[model samples]
Target chain A: MAIRYPNGRSYVGREPNKKPNRQKELTYSNRGMTLEEDLNETNLYYLEKAIAVIHKKPTPVQIVQVDYPKRSAAVIKEAYFKQASTTDYNGVYRGRYIDFEAKETKNKTSFPLSNFHAHQIEHMRQVLKQDGIAFVILRFSLTDEIYLLDALHLLYFYNQKDETRKSIRKSDIEKIGHSIKIGYHPRIDYLHIVDAVYFSDKL
Target chain B: MAIRYPNGRSYVGREPNKKPNRQKELTYSNRGMTLEEDLNETNLYYLEKAIAVIHKKPTPVQIVQVDYPKRSAAVIKEAYFKQASTTDYNGVYRGRYIDFEAKETKNKTSFPLSNFHAHQIEHMRQVLKQDGIAFVILRFSLTDEIYLLDALHLLYFYNQKDETRKSIRKSDIEKIGHSIKIGYHPRIDYLHIVDAVYFSDKL
Candidate 1:
């Protein structure tokens, strides 16, 4: 039997290839949520509860052509998604500037440094230099473990990246990074870890 | 006589309508640049000078459909520009979180409150609560004058908006707001005014 597709007509006896099981694993673990979606939901929960105000910046795009059919709406006809020069998220929390990049990897042993762009590292370095709280939120999808690793420690490994392995070991992360306990309400309550790690003097 | 248009067919009688003298006036004043353009150029200048790190967040768009014709590029087939809940620009300045909205008006007498959305006012209020430096850069387009109005004064007016006038008078802005000197480089050096107004203690 042949199945028809939306964009074309189908011939008899030709079966569409079934894709690999990308959905099954994610459906089984972490309630089928990506780290970015989870963080967005968590940020919303925080915002609603008035606990903190943080937002993921929108994906940058280079708009080429736009058609304004009406005064109110603009239709982007030609646009390309551009690489962001800065981190994914930034906002003010507890009167302190909070800046961080979030990344998720399936690797069990180490977080690959390839996940970060050099510009992001430079941005974090600049933030740290200005006394702003800068860090990386690393999520191990295999273990569902999340860690907030300060930029200073990340910089140390980044500078020695040429000589050393291009990844930070999970053991090192567990030692230097602060583990955020996953919760029900705000799934990943990272601010608790931020308080303990960055504002330890006040705490 | 016939005129050939770029889109093709030649027209015999229809004369191309000339747009009003809007372009002429702008060309004569401030080198024909709008306030937003001026600020964006100023931001780039500041970034190049290593004076402060500030960036206008990309306009948020709700992408409904995208086509992946090739592996390298994705074409946005259908998208709508989304209303941003937060202010237009934000970043770290002197280790302080700077959050502000910039607006320009052709009105010479007053700046209308309608230029700002309710959510933007709320966002600024939240920033203020968290001790972030929150303000608005109001530009009187006709006079080519800009003023940095603090969030405190904004909040006061916002709270009494229902009972008060819908617009803030130019005299009021000049009295309560710090005037930013238009400059050759970094066209609107509002940060200089910020240092004077907010960080006066440090100065």
Candidate 2:
């Protein structure tokens, strides 16, 4: 018998003598999920477990024309994407304001500073000055390694970019940042790193 | 001769003999600005002064089709608005997470409970559980009175709508909520109220 998955893909029942390849399935599980998808799943897990209240802001768009057809919902005819002025995700966790941006880089040797905009850097500075937790989640796609780098270190490298290397070397990230191991339930478990880095004493 | 404003409106020079009506201008200044506009201006003021980092999230939209022209930017051809799963505005303030939804009503006797959706109420509940500062900004257009009602009070009235009244009476709001005076600089100086309500010890 054949069964259809929720995604509408048909799957044939496993053959009586065939063994499931668990290792291959585990490896392929992380293949299609992007960093955004991982973070979204992780954030949803956080929210459902009553652990945190982080959310990604919607993509900004400039709407130019809309048509309100009779007895139908309004449809946008023309719109353009607008640049975001702040980081992607933010929320409250453990009585603290949490703010961070997530980016995936295919480059293995280093994470380029150009991945960040000057205004985003400036926004992080303001968040830090206001005593909120600020950081970035950097993921290297080739190795599937993820690191949480503090905004302070990111700002340092960004400000002195013209004088120094354009990107933060991978070695520096491994030394200064905390690695996040992807898991099944949450995908990217970052709040554990937050608890260690920001609320260690309380813990 | 006519001088054009940055908004593209052309204005003729004032008559030499005519006297400027400062009172009328002051009264009309608040006429054109909506509640969202006032909040946006106020949030910008807070951001520029390094006081807080608050922003109104962009409207959520579901893009269905996009067309990328040969030598131009991508244009969204078809899209529809999506219901927001959270409050419209959220950010950090003085090391605490701040979240709120703003609404303006022309009704004078009461603010309707229908102004809030179930998911928004649920979102506020989650934020409160996480120890974040959550509230709603209510603007009564008839009297031009603005009040910051705590989420606890809002949730109480919202949850008890069937047994009690369908709306929160203006009298109840005036007694429980904090009034924010309209100002010239920030337009709506809400942080002072925040200081009094949430950070009284530090203040």
TM-score for the A-chain in each candidate structure: 0.83, 0.86
Query: Using alpha carbons, what is the TM-score of model 1?
Result: 0.84
Give the share of true interchain contacts found in each model: 0.57, 0.90
Quality of candidate 1's docking, in CAPRI categories? acceptable
Question: TM-score of the second chain in each model?
Answer: 0.84, 0.86
After superposition, which runs of candidate 2 have C-alpha atoms over 4 Å from their true positions? A1-30, B1-30
Docking class of 2: medium
Against the hidden reference, what TM-scores do the models get? Answer: 0.84, 0.88
lDDT of 2 by residue, B1-203 (tens): 68889989787666542443554364534366788999999999999999999999999999999999999999999999999999999999999999999998989989999899999999999999999999999999767889999999999999898856789999999999999998878989899999999999876
Q: Clashing residue pairs in candidate 1, if any?
A: none
lDDT of 2 at B120: 98
Q: What are the iRMS values of all candidates?
A: 1.3, 0.5
lDDT of 1 by residue, B1-203 (tens): 67898979887553543333555544425467888899999988877776777788898988887778866799887788888989988888888898999999999899888888888998898888878999999988877888999988987776666656788989999999999888778789999999899889987
